[model samples]
Target: MLRTVSVLVDARDRAEALVRGHEERLEAVAGQSRRRPRPRVYTEEWDEPLITGMRWMSVLVRIACSDDVFPEPARQPAAKYRIVTPEAVLACRPEVILAS
Candidate 1:
C-alpha cells in the first residue's frame, strides 16, 4: 500500500499536460530511460515499493479468517497464520468525505 502511495505521489502524473509537454521526450524514451534520479519517498502502510531505484512492500493479511486460521476458542490453530476477511474490512465505512 505504501508503495502504491509512493507511486501515486512520485511517478503518476495528474495532468496530461506533463505528457503533452514532454511529447518529444516521451518519444525519446519510448523504451529506453535516461537513467535519471527520481524523487525519494518513504511511505509506510506495511512497507515500501520502489519505482526506479528500489521498493519495499509487506505481504500480510489481517484480522482473522476461518476457524482453522484463528481456531475456535480453546482449540489449537492448525494454520500458521490467519488472513483478514474482506467483509470485516468492508464493514467499516469511511468517516470522512471530500468535496471539490
Candidate 2:
C-alpha cells in the first residue's frame, strides 16, 4: 500500500511539473498582453453530486486562456483543494465558470 501511494504521488508530481513546463513555454511565446483586465474564472472539477474548486500548487501556474477567480488560494501552497458552496462561488462574481 505504501508503495502504491508513493508511486501515485510521484506520478502526480511529474504530471504537474509537465503541465507547468508547457504553460511556461506558452507564456514565453505569448509574452505580456494588453493591460486590459483578465476575467475572473471559477472552474469546477465536479457537479451534480457536489461542488468543488480546483486548489493546488498547479493552480498558481497560469494557463493560456484560463484565469482564476480567487487569489487567496494561489498564495496557499500546503492546501490541496476544498469544497465550495454555491453562495461562495457567487460571491466571487466569476466572469467565467467551467463546470464538468
Candidate 3:
C-alpha cells in the first residue's frame, strides 16, 4: 500500500510539472504573437464540491478580480463549478488540489 501511494505521488508530481511546462510554452507563444495581453482561464471542474459552498465562490471571485490576468465572467456571475465528489476530487485535476 505504501509503495502504491508513493508511486502515485510521484506520478502526480510529474504530471504537474508537465502541465506547468505546457503553460509556459503557451505563454511564450502568446508573447510572440501580436495579440493583446494574454487571457486568464477560470480552469475549474463542474462538480458538487463547488456547490457545497465553503466560501470558495467568494475566494475565487476575489482572486480573479484582483488578478490582472483573469477577467470577470461574461455574464453577471460565473457559471463554472468545482469538483466536490471524492472520486472527482481525486481525479487529479490540480497539482495541489484541496477539498474540505
Candidate 4:
C-alpha cells in the first residue's frame, strides 16, 4: 500500500514538472516576441495533462493559437488525424511486407 502511494506521488510530481517546463518555454517565446518591433505570425500548441483516477490517467488538453494582426489569416486550425494501415506501408515498401 505504501509503495503504491509512493508511486502515485512520483507520477504526480513528474506530470507537474512537465507542465512547468512547457509553461516556461511558452513564456520565453512570448517574451522574445514582445521584444520584436514587428508583429509575429506563428501558432503555438501545447498539451496540458489533467490527472484523474487513482491510477493517475492523463487527459490531453490541446490548445492552438496564433498572434497575427489579420483576423482572416490569423486562424490557426487544429491538426487532422489520419489512420494508416500495414497495407499502405507495404505499398510504399514492397520489400518489407507485413504478415497478418
- Say which candidate scores most in lDDT: 2
How are the candidates ranked when ordered by lDDT, highest leading? Answer: 2, 3, 4, 1
TM-score of each: 0.15, 0.49, 0.26, 0.33
Q: After superposition, how far is residue 66 of candidate 4 from its true place, in Å?
A: 7.3
Best by TM-score: 2
- Candidate 3 residue-wise lDDT at 56: 49
Model 2's number of clashes is 0
| Alpha-carbon runs more than 4 Å astray in model 1 | 1-14, 30-52, 55-100
Residues 1-100 of candidate 3: C-alpha lDDT, one tens digit per residue: 4445657777766666677797687567645643443222233334443422234433443333322111222222534532235554345233333223
Show where candidate 2 strays beyond 4 Å: 1-24, 29-36, 55-61, 65-67, 71-81
- Give, for candidate 2, the lowest lDDT window spanning 10 residues: 57-66
Candidate 3 global Cα RMSD: 13.6
| C-alpha lDDT values of all predictions | 0.27, 0.58, 0.40, 0.33
- Candidate with more favorable, higher TM-score: 2 or 3: 2
Which residue ranges in model 4 land beyond 4 Å of their true spot? 1-10, 40-66, 69-100
Ranking of predictions according to TM-score: 2, 4, 3, 1
